[model samples]
Target: MSATTPNGAPASQPKKTPQIPKGKTELKILMLHGYTQSGPLFSSKTKALSKLLTKALSPAPYNLHPTLIFPTAPHRLRPSDIPGYTPSDGAEGAEAEEDDESDNWAWFRKDEATGTYLGFEAGMRAVATAIADAGGVDGVCGFSQGGAVAALVASALEKPHREPAPSPSPETDTSWLPLLRAANNDAPLKFCVVYSGFYAPPPTLGWLYAPPIATPTLHFLGSLDTVVEESRSQGLVDRCVDPTVVVHPGGHYVPVAKDWVLVLAGWLRKRYDEPAGTAKKEEGNL
Candidate 1:
């Protein structure tokens, strides 16, 4: 079946086939793309990695099959062009142009100063709905800005939403409290994979708190990444409650390194092989 927007725009819903390597247990992996790109863009770009992952997880010495779910970002465009929002050349340019013609989209607005995202709650909710519609997910993987958004989405899911209480006194300070309450009421997410991501909180918006996430996570950063410095990615990794970092020698793009596909495949294999009860127990604890 095809997926389409309310306006009949083409969407990225892939036909559900029996998970590859039938008879083996399957895990659902939701992959989100970086800025200026759609789900199908990443899905096509990461085909090699996905194939490698499927092979690596096969039973015997390794037996596993993961059904990857790629969800398109909700279409959006800046009302006015913002500086530093232009796409780079080559594949990036092609993807950006395609998205632009379709009405350029972004998961959230980027804060130029700290690189933190703003107005991400709406995108997060959309992603959550997509995942639920796709039959839930065993794990999530994202690249660059997608990575930052994924982390925030995972954090949001772990807390329960609470209505903000109004303060009678004008002198009273209740700014941060409301945000904290909202973030404290979300659902729990499983493992996450972040590539070339930054971890700055939103400016003056206490709603964008980065709680100590307990989900197992894998972080990949390019040593030569200028767009998102390795130091920044490392900082985010350090803040994660439990995370493993892998440093690749290259630039910002994931396909630049030859071994990245292998590395990512291995990570996915490990994530999808965890006992079913473990995920359930973790969800319960959250």
Candidate 2:
């Protein structure tokens, strides 16, 4: 009836052990938030999607669970950098900058006249540190500016592994690439999820798209996204070898609706089916 330790003052019932299922799999994903959006804010925005991903992807035998990690961008944007900002909003924008502390964030800041990002190296370093600390991630997802960075990250991991070299000049420092490549236990990310992403047309980053992105990518585009136009998002799709595109009714935001999420889940399931250690088979679209 009862089992007790040494001293026989009283007897107690033995605790029943937990019956856990086997073959259950879990994956960690790195989420890059859009400009002006921090990690916590992005997490709140996609709470529904994260939950839906678990439910839809873990129906039974798959039993797939995902851990999403969001890392905030390091650069702080000026109030003038906010979208829809107008000169009439001068006083209000200043007040907003004084009131809000988290809105002005960016992965890279663009010089309007020159049309080039100024902080690419620093931003990439921050992302690389996050991935290295996580020991690696299964995939990456982003929206808007974050989506552009996600595409580059996946490309960086696709490069051949090499030991990081000495710090090079700002314009010439490709050293971070090797470090990011080495961070994933020397493996490339499994997939990428891009929402309203656009190609970054920079001379230094030309190598990223020289060979079409081989990683399996799922792109979400909004028909009415005025901020990052449909054409720009298509530009990124054109760089991927064979991308799965999902067009939704919304604009410039990740759709967390069940229907839209299921599309992502289906694509993810197909990716999971591929044998581990094997790169996704290239599909012709370029």
Candidate 3:
């Protein structure tokens, strides 16, 4: 029988509604802040980026949703330790031992001569504790020095294909391994996001890069960034087995504009939708 809408004429069929994919589980990402910045500070800075990601990836075309975790570094920094430090006019030029501001922190102190991080183990352990407490993560995202740590942390989670697993170096602290293992639950690191990141030039850190990490990496480089220098960020790209590069027209800060954020969403969508090592497929296009 034909149905009518209060008339003899037959009612037209209703148009079909579009179906949207809903992800079964949300992937977790541990976020690391840049030097002289705490997790909370960085989180505040990235609110725009996070909001854009949610809008772009949570419905319709892209179904991937990510939960981000931000944890503070364990090391407290002195005024001298921070970049762009300026001594006060008082005290006959004698410096204050501690900064009154509570937010001062660093993932590690740089040894300019040797190109080594003085407290990498302590800093990484602090990060690991945060992840372990959060019940693990699927990826890591970081900025500047934190971005460098993201790469190192990813490499550390990866077991070298052929190695005896030797002891930690004399200059480096290895206490982070236990917590790192706990944070990852013995699973491979799925992906890493680096903003204005660089390669760790120290000989002690060679192990982390020698094997060439296979985790899908999305690296953001600022064309005008004087702090991390383009060469340094490129050096990191050269070390990764597969990396997705996004160049922004700005400086040291993370670009949170719609265009940049959408680029990130697209990369992340591919990360979730495609298998590992397939990132190279889109290399030419990017």
Candidate 4:
């Protein structure tokens, strides 16, 4: 259950890939599921993709052993008196009812007007801790609400530190930058992959200005995604500097196209395989 890097160093090993060969870095991906679903469900859907990536790149030139860390969404009650609590997918509806009965599990609830199930600040802190526990994350990937959260984390990590208040001049306002810098002091994220995610404005973020996230991001969208309109997703991508976009001809679900997975896998490999100093140099040029 342990992975090794190209230099024969041990990497984060998941149970699935028990006996990985030496000189291959174990690629640990933290996967956050979309709204109305849990981590296990997300893991199930991506099992094939994970296996394919693992098999395709086992040694040397493409040495990457991928592991998925699926975190459960915190629980919260469904909004009372909401007429259309039932999901379009029958299976999802049943699962929601089951959760309601158990009084646990939800990504977010509009009934209480809470933006996210665990509250934005608390949720980000939890995610940060999880990444740290994973020996520092290689990359962050998510779907829908999870995607939005991932983007938020990426943005927070790249924000530069600002000076304290009480400056002599009124033109010097460095309060917000300081807060963001503190939040992201530990590790800088390498890249991000977001599926069916939207970029909400600063007002929507409770007046918290989003810091520039220089991480190379890949955004995937379904042409017919009703839940998250293409325009909204594109807008989010537009805000990011030099983000890559992949469009699928399907709906809200992750594109089943094998090529997309391959591309993503390649991106991760390139980021992780390169020396840290080299990666930083390349990022600086960008």
Give the runs in model 2 whose Cα sits over 4 Å from its true position.
Answer: 1-23, 87-100, 159-170, 274-286
Listing every candidate in turn, what is its Cα RMSD in Å to the true structure after a full C-alpha superposition? 7.6, 11.5, 14.8, 9.2
Taken over the whole model, the C-alpha lDDT of each candidate is: 0.62, 0.76, 0.77, 0.62
Screening candidate 2 with a backbone cut-off below 3 angstroms (N, C-alpha, C), the clashing residue pairs are none
Name the weakest run of 10 consecutive residues (lDDT summed) in model 3.
7-16
What's the CA error at residue 187 for candidate 1, in Å?
A: 7.2
lDDT of 3 by residue, 1-286 (tens): 6443231212323423323346535667889999888777888999999889878778755465667778777677777776787766773235553444345677889888876778887788777777776677888999998999999888888754322246465545666776687677867677899999999987766777877877778899998999998889999999998678888999998999999998888887786666765756875464
In TM-score terms, candidate 2 sits at 0.81
On a 0 to 100 scale, what is the lDDT of residue 42 in model 4? 83
Q: Flag regions of model 3 displaced more than 4 Å.
A: 1-24, 60-62, 91-100, 159-171, 275-279
Q: Over the stretch 202-267, how does candidate 4's per-residue lDDT look in tens digits?
A: 244522223445677888888888888777787678767667777778888876457877766666
Candidate 1 local lDDT, 59-167, one digit each (tens): 6555667777777766455423333655554656565455435534566776677664555655565576567666566677888878877666565455453222354
Residue lDDT tens for model 2, 33-141:
8988877789899999999998887766567878787777777665667777555635775656643443456789988887878888777877887787677888999
Extract clashing residue pairs from model 3. Answer: none
Error of 3 at 107 (Å): 0.6
Range of the 10 consecutive residues with the lowest summed lDDT in candidate 1:
277-286
- Error at 243, model 2, angstroms: 1.0
Shift of residue 79 alpha carbon in model 4, Å: 7.3
